[model samples]
Target chain A: MNLYYRGYLLGDVRRFPHWSEPSDAAGAEDAALADETIVYLRDDFSVVRSPVGADQGVLWDAMTPQWREFCDTVLRFRPPRESADGPA
Target chain B: MDRPDLGEQERGQAVGLPYIVQGGGENLADRLAEDRAAIRDRLRTDGAVLLRGFDVGGTDGFAEAVRALSGELLPYEERSSPRETIKGRVYSSTEYPPHEEIFFHNENSYQQSWPMTLYFHCVQPPAAHGATPLVDTRRVLAAIDPAVVQEFSRRRWMVVRNFHPDFGLPWQQVFGVADRAEVLKLCGDRDIDAEWRSPDQLRTTSIRDAVHVHPDTGEPVWFNHIAVFHMSTLSADLRDGLRELFPEPDLPANSYYGDGGVIPDDVLAHVRDCYRSAATRFDYRRDDVLVIDNMLTAHGREPFSPPRRVAVAMAEPTDAGARP
Candidate 1:
């Protein structure tokens, strides 16, 4: 899923299994990102980005905390729309 | 999912793929009336918006929500795939078999007039893999080889369709009329050329410019049914059977150059590839209402297991007035 603020791509939280502590986003098991400033949300619920021009950064995990937070916060503010025509 | 219990909420707009907005409950209709302007702005910027987890009252509320955002709803004219009407202006999504993928195209892009906006409400999501795939037409235009785009722009595009008593949708069902003279009049008014090869067989042809300028945004969009209706886009088995049974012009459906010449197979493939490359797809959840700016985005269905129900409605009739 992509996260957008004012129609522009903000960093998004996505899930893919990783083999080890992420050296870089490219070296992570997920499909590589090209030269993006890779940010990692470690299991401790803290956010960290790889050093500038650094080759590697270790990440314990990016977990349910960020995902749940984004969803709850956005929905609380945004207040989604609705449709009828429920199941027959 | 654990979210902190806050005393109150901050209000603003943010977008996701399809730009999800949530939290309308029993007062969905009123909330819709209040937020309609915001929703319209989001749709224009995002191309699509998915409204999730709301009561929406019922079918009446659905129509109310649509009316709040887009003034009037439209009937599905110039029909292609089979669909059943659900309520006054609501319809079941195209009634193709579960296993067939409906390729990406803007709704009614082949017609002289089309809906500027589309609304889809998921009643029941499929057992598996029944996503509505989307492609931004602007991205499709950017990805195509300029040479192919130039050719299509210069020549425009043509769609030829054959209707027979025993095969596909007959003239009556396709035209929503039984009178021959009425059909001819409809064709003439719509700029479609109609010919009768036999008492029961009819062929109609339409030439349309392949590119369109977005009415509000003023951006050129690669919009049409060119790749979608081209013969080469069909599955090989179906293609072989149809080709063996009928000549090109007599096939159930096909697309060509504006002057009635064949579009190259490779060119069609490239067009399809461009659409696929820019495509984004998502699974449906019940009560998820997806609103789309039709001209800016192309949508299609994925083959599914079974029991998928999505209700659709079109609004804001827009005529692409300049015919080729």
Candidate 2:
């Protein structure tokens, strides 16, 4: 299944990636190492952990530290259920 | 298609053929009768019929041919865009792409008085891609519910005109109205109505529902959104969203709002599904002319590679009046 940013429709996402290196690197000497360390996401998400073929740009941009922090906070503070049985 | 009743004098005579030599023609009366009879039958049953070998002499001969057969000058104002001077509208698939699906609709549906008959001549055929598709509005209308038909007859529809100003040419200039009163004046006060937004733009006004009954045959016709509202271009976002909401609406990209605006989400979804499940398509070939009752049928183009060229001629009976 595909994931959406906010409440966007599934088809709206052009690309998605899995993992990546830190956004900032020390100097020019570490540029090559940073590039190699990054992991990308695939559109189909079949190989979620493989990082064999994923969109590098999407992984780097959409999944920034800020976005991750947002996701973390939302997960930690879940809203109370309206009903015990669940919404009708 | 055989008629043994044709007399010997009419056997070899060309009835609808415009370029056929007439000086030594066998019996003009019999040939004319045959031609008229054929046209009448086609109109009554199929809503349209073709006059094969009507005239192939040459493009220059087209005007003369039309004058002799219909006893009227071709409307110079109705020529296709860019070449208004040309006497006939050209339709060719080789020049245009098939991606632009023309909506199924009656010709001049927006006009107060539409032509009674329309004729097309194919000058060239596409290599593999273009085909003209048409749907009998009458057939569609006959199959729907009566309440739906009543709903349409009660409303005033809108058509937004967005064509560029000064487009028609020296013979005729493109003009638009802004309100129902002006629309009535432009259309000669036929029951058909419109509302203009700008000098060169307008909207459909006073439209019937998606289903209506033909005044002549009393046969129910599916003369609704598929023909009138569906012949326009819309934004990709709105189009996709509407399609998603109404997965089966079969909404083509062209259909849009009366103000030339995006249709509302809920309304779009509702109409899209209704059309998707009920509409049928037929392919048209080069030189294959289809005669249809403007009130009973809706015509649309299937998207093809450009430049799509199709020539059309409209014929109105002497007494039909200018009311579509």
Candidate 3:
């Protein structure tokens, strides 16, 4: 898929919610937003804020709240899938 | 400046080989709990991701980070290197002699099932060198001669391992079971061909794809132990010594064509060059945790002076047969 983390500028998530550039090239931060917001990634790439009090994001795994927002937001990143009869 | 530490790397060199996630001294386990999926996606895209300046308490804390990011840690199976267990799922990174450099290899590439992710935690930076050099398998594949790649793809490659009494690990240790029947059952299950040369000596052979498709990225990658498992890859001194000590069929470990034909020495040399052309490295600092998407990147050790300590964990099982 086109969605990949080529490179990104790191910042305090508090100060930089839209921390990473939307494309592969590294660029200046889009310092326009200041809340727990899902920003731009290619259409396939998405970010969700970890659910507040009760609205658990569409996932069942335990995670730090911030990550709860985007756990299943990307490629089928479930735990390594195994069958009732596991890997040979 | 030539040392290639995180600051020097971020200053605009190494092509930002793998994206860096600066934790700003935050507890890494905590950060992992928050955005493991996003972090993992970043890793899958970059082939590797460096988690620098984070607080990974110790072996215990490192396990916490692994569980947070990977959900479960895969136990060390079909063992090769001598790794000492420190805590649950956290083991000392390949206790090869401190002065010997390990050639580049994807972990468990020869096996039927392998971990999709590997996390290396640098507990203490080595005194001199000891950087874990990394090679993008996609880049390695791109650099190889297409003919060489195609020939290997068609023929596949075979690994012949000899567990001897004098040289190499005993089969009991490698198999982790003392019972011969259990070992045979495991071999049959894993599709490995096993033979008993002598009562205490065992020889096993397995054939696997030299090129494999990345599970997430879907790109065909040059992924195999063809070179590393070949006899010619060793230094002339060691190669000659081993040859003199054992018959060709009884060497500690060696590789051949899937049909068991000899792979020319020249082909092995060309393969090594492609890996070299695509390799990159960064010096480790204490608390630098490197998370690798195992299929996308091949990693190796650079020989270093003593006092270097790195912890490792593997997770996310991906079956080899699942790929087309």
Candidate 4:
């Protein structure tokens, strides 16, 4: 299943592919992106969305180019399926 | 290396670590100054060294024992929980309501700096049931599911805290400064992201490694407060009450993955289970001292009846990334 990250910016949804977890340059974005609310999504249609970090909008730019593009595209934003466990 | 007369060891079968009782007439307080290195060696090797019959007299004596073990006690700075500083670097341990159980955690693991060692002295045992349970973090790492451990390592963790006077300790009390500018400076120095969530409220988030190798022992350990700080850990009633009482952004404290995603509840449940299965506990008698290597061990409190008093002191501050 493909992994994607969904971030909330000013009530708008920014969807992108989930990249490798931050260690150095690739993970932590710049300070300016601290306002975005990040959440992890999966193609398996799981209803639960795991929270990444809040107020870390600065790190959005640190994502890879491909993931950044995915975040910019809103049409591809697929919501998780409804399940018994409900959204997390 | 001088040693105290020891009594029968207990709990050797249940967990790998055993509790050593001191023979009568021997006081660790008098002996620790001369034998600090030996005791420190034992702490590093065993993860926890429980001393009963040490005759650590009172708060003053406990502070002395701490000083003997690790020179120059560090002030409890950048605090999250409420605790009273009794005397020069000695403080009451997380002075929470006696009915609540304080979950196991490495001291200051959420901060950019933490003490390498911790000392807890039992000034007075609880009236009914009070024991400081201990768990080896290495065992916590091993007990968790491999996938869960892998996920934690990859994603890391970030603790988001909203400090306000309405609930919990305010930022002014936590940072030991009343001025907003000073608090901002302290946050800046510690690499914490601080913001004025509102006119009177402050929000801070700090990222930390979920798993880290012990600085002295070079052994991997689960060393973050994700389980303890997560909102899911609270009871359903308490969580609901809190959500109703405060706005979402102003909730007292909670945690998330380093990348700003939610940590699954099931994962945290598994983690709590591992901690429970591995925890070791011994009755705390008066005049007892427990010294633990903070990175190698995690500690928590059990719900007790009343009249329980334990003093804590920390030393040997190790800055983040300083561990080789």
By TM-score, the best candidate is 1
lDDT (Cα, tens digit) per residue for candidate 4, span A1-88:
2122221221122223453333342234643222122222223322112222223223233435564345324323333222222111
Give the Cα error of residue B281 in candidate 4, in Å.
Answer: 0.6
Q: Which stretches of candidate 3 lie over 4 Å from their true place?
A: A1-88, B1-15
User: Where does model 1 exceed 4 Å of error?
Assistant: A1-88, B1-16, B24-26, B322-324
Lowest lDDT block of 10, candidate 3 chain B: B1-10
Backbone clash count, each prediction separately: 5, 65, 5, 18
Against the true structure, what is each candidate's TM-score? 0.76, 0.49, 0.75, 0.73
Q: Return whichever of 1 and 4 wins on lDDT.
A: 1
Better lDDT candidate (3, 4)? 3
Error of 3 at B224 (Å): 0.9
lDDT of 1 by residue, B1-324 (tens): 111123221222122246667653545556667777777887776688877777766677787778878987888887988889899989999998787678889999989899999998888888776778776777678667889888988888999999977878778988889988789899999989998888888889998989998888777788899887887887787789999989876899999999878888888876886776445556688777788999878888877888999889999988876332
- Candidate 2, residues B1-324, lDDT tens digits: the string is 011122321322211111111212223223334465545444644554433333334444433334433444335232122332344432222222245444456655444445556655455543433444443454344333445444444442444333333432211233233454654476445443444445544333333234444555665555534333443233365446656743322222133433334444544443332332222222234333444565555555545454445565666632223213
Per-model TM-score of chain A alone?
0.23, 0.19, 0.20, 0.22
Give per-residue lDDT, candidate 4, residue B298: 89
TM-score, candidate number 4:
0.73
Model 2 error, position B15 (Å) = 27
User: DockQ, in order, for the candidates?
Assistant: 0.06, 0.01, 0.02, 0.01
Chain B TM-score, candidates in order: 0.92, 0.59, 0.93, 0.92
